[model samples]
Target: MTHSERWCWYSLLLMLIWLPIPLGSHRMWSWSIFEIWISCQTLLLSASLWHQFPWQKIRKFVWLLAPLSLFQCWIAIQAIPLPVEVLSIIAPDVAQVYRQVGADVGSLSYDRYATLTGLMKGIAYTLFAFNAVVLIHSVKRVKTVLYALVISGTFQSFYGVLTVLLNSHQSWFFGLPQGHRATGTFLYFNHFANYLVMCLCLGIGLIVSQLHQTESGSWHVRIRRWFSAVMSAKMMIRLCLIVMVIALIMTRSRMGNAVFFSVIACGGVIALCFYKRRPRALTALIISMMIIDTFLVGTLFGIDKVKQRIEATSIETETRDQAVQWSLDIIRDYPLTGTGLGSFYSTFPHYTHYNIGYYNYAHNDYVQFAAEAGIPAVVLLSLPILVALWFCFNVIRTRHSKTLKGTALGCLMGILAMMAQISVDFHLQAPANAVTFILILVLSGCVRQIQVRPESHPVAVDHLLLKN
Candidate 1:
């Protein structure tokens, strides 16, 4: 690797180490550390890789997502109106308090919590822009970074499982607290579960790719050896996957459970379709995943509150339904330009008398984005996934490397899974999820480029190539 590539790899390792720090501790210095590292990396790239920035190539992709960012910025400055019909229903005393608070604090009284969260979201978007630039400029460095992410992510899975088994509740040096929730570094169990799901997807990709390579060997003897390795890796990956699923169930997060299984199923179908040449094997893989998932769900969680929570989809609770309705009203009032970046709660009482203390966000990412940034922001934010899907389709169709092919499919499936989850919960709103999403997008982009690039020279494949 070149000097720049080496530096990038080291920087990524640091990021992985920083990722699990709890957000509430004095030692929670990972955020600033990563910010500094990324800033420096950006400077280095600007100075050395100026000519190879791939601006034209990546501009198309960036432009697809830029409108959302700009729209969010625009909405962050506007004031949204609450519907008169809804406002009429508020009790006189509550209405008086709402008006007084609104008039006194303006933005502060309305969205005290969102002030910090909105700023964080802005920072995340900036980081995402930087990540995109880095990804387009240096494919090799991006690949190395992604590989490091996979390794660290696997370790995190193990850590999460251990945390569950030990039932530990101590806070980590990074300020992350352990509790009944499965929060690693993030304070919220839901956010932690989302992060785990993404990492699990990456692990699945790595394991499957390895198995395929081992199975497709040259001679009968080699094929036998490859098959053995493939089986072993597959078993190990399944074990890890089971642990991850159990963790998700334990989180008691309805959205997380739904997303977890949905991704696995969607990913299997996609894999089967891509491997149409081996229809029987593909079918068997799908069946096996279904069977394993069903058995694991029954065995690990049993039939109880956790299982019930996972199965319960409708807003059965009145409070939750009210919150959802209030969110809808906010979106309707600010259809084009939202109240402000973090002003949803501030503006919510004007729509309904639902107690604001119980709610922080809309509990839905798309609604949150629309309510905070407006419709345009929502569209802009969704561009990456659409572009990624198109890119994955092309890569899967044209790529020769089985590893690349599986990765393309896996990344696509993972993104889709996360998107499905986002429809019900605001996982992407948190730093942990944002960080993981950006990493996945960067990795997917790199994999696509590697697969499509012309092969004029001989390839030097890794010795740790995927067997199967």
Candidate 2:
């Protein structure tokens, strides 16, 4: 990597740690702290990468860009000024809002302002993901990013678990509401759980990859290996995984808990299938994960509440049911042109039946995305996960190193977990979780770095995976 590239990588790490602070850098009402900071950070990195931009590297991941650009294109269509008569048919709910104010509702979308803001936020996130793909170009940097993710996630989970154990209602560090759940630095427990779930997936891969527990000789060797508390990479990853699981349990989020364990299970299966050479070690890893996760974390965190929450699921909560119904109506009325991005908070209120309270989030990302950006946006977003899965499985089958393959498979599971969790909660909407989500994507989608020989210099793959 070049000198400038090193600084850019450092900047990326700082941003990862920084995004969760200051109320999770959420509340982007009117140019909030995250908005200003993210904009500057994104632009600077984008400019630096512009000169020696990894077009070859980036184009290989065009599966991501296609849907992203399509979503933005849908946003652009929403911004255009259209004839009122035409819009009334395409976006009647939006027209109704404008008509309610005696303004030319039919001439424009009610969500134009929100669409612009949402598009800007999406752009910033994409830029940061690209930066990671460019800078994290070697095994060393890749390991650094993964460990950074695990370490930062562990710190937040530790704080969250600490606060919960003390029965505090707000953070000792940020003074943010604790809400009876382990939210850590995030505003919602689900979001904190979301962040930790990804970390846990990574931790599992790291632990498996770093595991040197091979049965070679006698029972004494095996016994010593099992009991040793060495401060090695494997041990740290294992430790981080344990704490993150415990903290996730503390969050008491039903979907969060369910999605994480399910994904972890799937990850274990992937490891066994692909890491066939390490059958014994992988089996031990799986057994250890299961024992630690169930007996230790679940037992201590009082998993009953979450279990009951999951089993007692009805049609839906009153607020969420109402929100989903209203969102559907909004989508139906504006099938072609969405009400606009970021309009869920403003538009859902008009369509609410019970007026239980204000709902900024639609609680379901799918419902909200479809309502805000139309069904096409939902389609655009959904297909990328499939593409991601394909990319991950390709790496598993093609990559030479066991660690690189495990990391890719782990990221695929993490993305799956995120998708499942997002079905019930808007965790990805949070700045911290979203940035982490993108970083994981970069890791999963990365081909060049993983394909390079490990013994080569960091920049050896600067031109890998591209045809001249």
Candidate 3:
């Protein structure tokens, strides 16, 4: 990597590390700072590498990114003031509000300031993902990113676990009493669990990259390979995975825990059934993850609490379900053009019938996005994930490089987990989780675009090449 590229890479690592520190950067001020930081990084990197920009690679994902671009444009449109006639034609409710207040002009957005802030943050996230793709031009860089995520997750896991063990109720930075829940630095347990799920996926992918092919060999050869693994650096990642899993269980988040285990099971099944040359080591890794992480470590770390939460959850008891109903009302009223991006808080109250508490977010990302940006915007947001999922699936089915396949599997599982979890929670609303989700999406789509070199053994490829 060039000096500038190296700095850019470090900048991404710094961003990843800093994101979850300040309540998942969900606060306006925290997110704004990172937005400026990432935008500056993008500008500087583009200035330094404009001549050698990877246009060819970026072009490959044009179809995937086109909708996102349009969605951003849509957000901008929501924030832009339009003539009264134009506003009336597009979003009559917004225009009606203006007229009732004796104003002739207004934006589609009910809260223009919130929409603009959302737009700025959205742009920063887009550029960060773009910069990540541009900088990660090699398998070595991919591993570096994965390791950085694992390390960050491990730190969060350790901190959260330690806080609970110390009987501390307050977060070190946010001063929120977590009440035995391991939220780390994040304000919400669900978002922290979601973040860990993504990190675990990447860490598990790293382990898969380290898996030796299950060829017919003598017992001595198998034993030697197994012993080498026991002594290898993979143990650190394995330990990290364990720590994160423990923290995940401590969160007692029903969907978060469910999605993590579900992804592992589904990913394993897919690999066994679909991978072109599935390795036995891969099967072993998956089995170990399910058996050790879920049964053993989980047993010791409040898995029962998560199960209790799941079993005890009911529609009547849960107010979020009611909130979703009200959110659906908003979506129903504004199907074509939503109330506006970041307008859920402002728009939800008028439709809310019952006491669902003072909910700023709809608690369901799908519902919230639909309520804020309309059904079409929801489609635009989901399109890239669907496209990226296909890319990762193909990588698993067709690629020979273990690192590529592992990364693909990680991206695949992470994306699926996020998709599943977002059904009832707004984890993606947290900027940290959102950016991490985007990075995984980028990795899934871009992994296939990068080429690989010939290697004697697929298992040894990443390690040897990275070392060299």
| Runs in model 1 lying further than 4 Å from the true structure | 1-5, 24-36, 63-65, 68-120, 132-146, 172-178, 213-223, 226-239, 275-285, 301-305, 311-318, 451-468
Predicted candidate 2 versus true structure: per-residue lDDT over 174-199, tens digit per residue: 67666677888777777888888888
* Residue 75's lDDT in candidate 3: 96
Model 2 clash pairs are none
lDDT of all the models against the reference?
Answer: 0.59, 0.73, 0.86
Candidate 2 TM-score to native: 0.87
TM-score of 1: 0.76
Model 1 per-residue lDDT tens digits across residues 276-374: 232233455556556776575636664255566655655554365567667887777656655557666566667777454557667777887777666
Cα TM-score per model:
0.76, 0.87, 0.95
Highest lDDT scorer: 3
Shift of residue 211 alpha carbon in model 1, Å? 3.9
What's each prediction's clash count? 16, 0, 0
